[model samples]
Target: MKLSLFLVSTAGLWVAANANSVNNKQTKNDVCTHPFVDINGRCLFVNNFAQMDWDAARAFCAGFQGDLVTLDEANLLADIVDFIYKEGLTDRSYWIGGSAGAQTGAFVWPDGSLVRMGTPCWGVLDNIQRPGAEPNEKCIALNKDNFFFFDNFNCEGEISVICEYKFQRENRWAEGGCATMKSSAVFVFLAAALLGSDGATEAGSHVKTDVCTHPFVDINGRCLFVNNFAQMDWDAARDFCAGFQGDLVTLDEANLLADIVEFISKEGLTERSYWIGGSDRALEGEWTWTDGSSVRMGTPTWGANGQNQQPTGGSEENCVGLDNANFFFFNDFPCVTAMSLICELKL
Candidate 1:
């Protein structure tokens, strides 16, 4: 009878220990508060509580075991904007994890990855309202008033902040690292919904795997190299790209212009113009890409309102470039004028 009682007691103890372990796992899974949301497996906390300078804002996020939100993916950025809009914080600016740091205009995230430039990442600031040259603006903020486009602000300036932590639910945090969500269907649907037609291709869609070599960014399956090494005239720039099995980049879509601009801005070339592949050399008043395709004109294509702003230099300015003076707009310039250039390679 004593042996029977001892076995029963041991079994009961084992059951109690297992129950406690399960409860602990459950608690960890549901860790975040009401204000935080699970976005693509990351717990994002949007702090609109008070405005603080960039350094202070970073400290606030760190206090919560997170860092200022680092938007490394384009789709993730779209989701963040959607989340902010849903929460009715569209009027306020929020500090994110990006700064030009010691290298002005070379924005990098906390993890040492370079921030992606241009559209969907940067809000389109009105050309007329844009500050005429503020080199002091090194830190980046989400200008919610302008649809969450990243805007450069002084580091010392006070702003709200967004904090993000790697999702540690499922007891994966202690095992090795943060656990990635396992649903492929969900990832596909999210990418489609956030990016729509203009954003980058779907996650697993057939895109060129091997386009250009190292140091070139892949945009919409095309490899683009922004040449900071050589500044040459339009023809000479074209030759430089040719040497690398590519040509000066040709802006096919209006959205593409933004991506190129972002790349240039991130490269710290905000004040320098770069040659793209567009010229009326074939027929006056009619632009054609180097590959012999007709240029798309008008809204979403040309910067600064319409075609009137572009090809403005008349017959003399045949080659096209992204103008530095008005960074968002394109301007016609003499083909012989020396400038930085962007090269593109298709897979």
Candidate 2:
């Protein structure tokens, strides 16, 4: 009688443990139905209110607990349009992850996934072609004039931003590999958790942690300078700076100019006039950016007739070159001077 009673107790305990395990599995499966926040089955709405560069916008989204807008699934497009209308984003344009930044032909999202947008679909019937249109390049923007519409803007242009959160991928294991060894070894070496894609190690499979690094780094994390140029034309310099995840430096304030001056002074780039984008080539006496935006020469950081000098008698200071001392005025340096210009991109 005693032996039979012990056997019954052991069997009952085993059944209860198994039942609990089954219930836990069902709960985990049910939770997988929701992708992420504000997103119903892989759709989300994001609205922007500030003008920023493509890179700047991406950074904003990452901080918003989301990644830069990626047009992958069909529902995402519809959600974005609805958000734009609801939020009344008719002030200016915004940027999405359609640009080939820092690299070309390889367009990837902030998460390093390939860009995948469905057939060209715009909310409005605007004749303007977006990034995927004929003669298309990778770069999309939210246009304000055409509310609920998108167009292809230059990747370097500053605009507002939006982002969407994505779900972490579920990992799995394959057969006939080193996965078996990892599982058995986990108990033996319990000091450290050997992390793998699906909690199992396999040959030729690399497990990666979700670590994000900034593309641009500086000594003080404020101003970034690219100081590697021998002799390239202004156009070539601009291209080189853009390639470095930045553009020819634009000075919006005196402090920004001071930062550049400090950077140049530290680098000992004296006696060389670097090319900047402050050329009045298209319009005389009226400064404009390469992207064709009005530039207000806020304050003179130079002596009288410093940047105001039209050396070429063309009625415009087409190119800018740095001089010594607190005089931060730019002269009409020839485009072919090949001086190293500064490139400042949004982080």
Candidate number with greatest lDDT: 1
lDDT by residue for model 1 (131-178), tens:
214788888887655556577889899988888764432233211001
Count of backbone collisions in candidate 2: 2
**lDDT of all the models against the reference?**
0.60, 0.43
Candidate 2, residues 1-347, lDDT tens digits: the string is 00011112321220011111111222223332212223323322244445677767777666545566555432334344444543455465667655554555545555455543212223222322234443343566655544433456666677766555433222422111101111221111122321211222112221111221232223212334445455577788788766654567664333334445544545566556666666766667666655566553312222122123223435523665554322344456556666766664432
Least accurate stretch of 10 residues (summed lDDT) in model 2? 14-23
Candidate achieving the largest TM-score: 1
Task: Name the runs in model 2 displaced over 4 angstroms.
Answer: 1-223, 302-317, 324-327
**What RMSD value applies to candidate 2?**
24.7
In order of appearance, the predictions have TM-scores of 0.44, 0.33
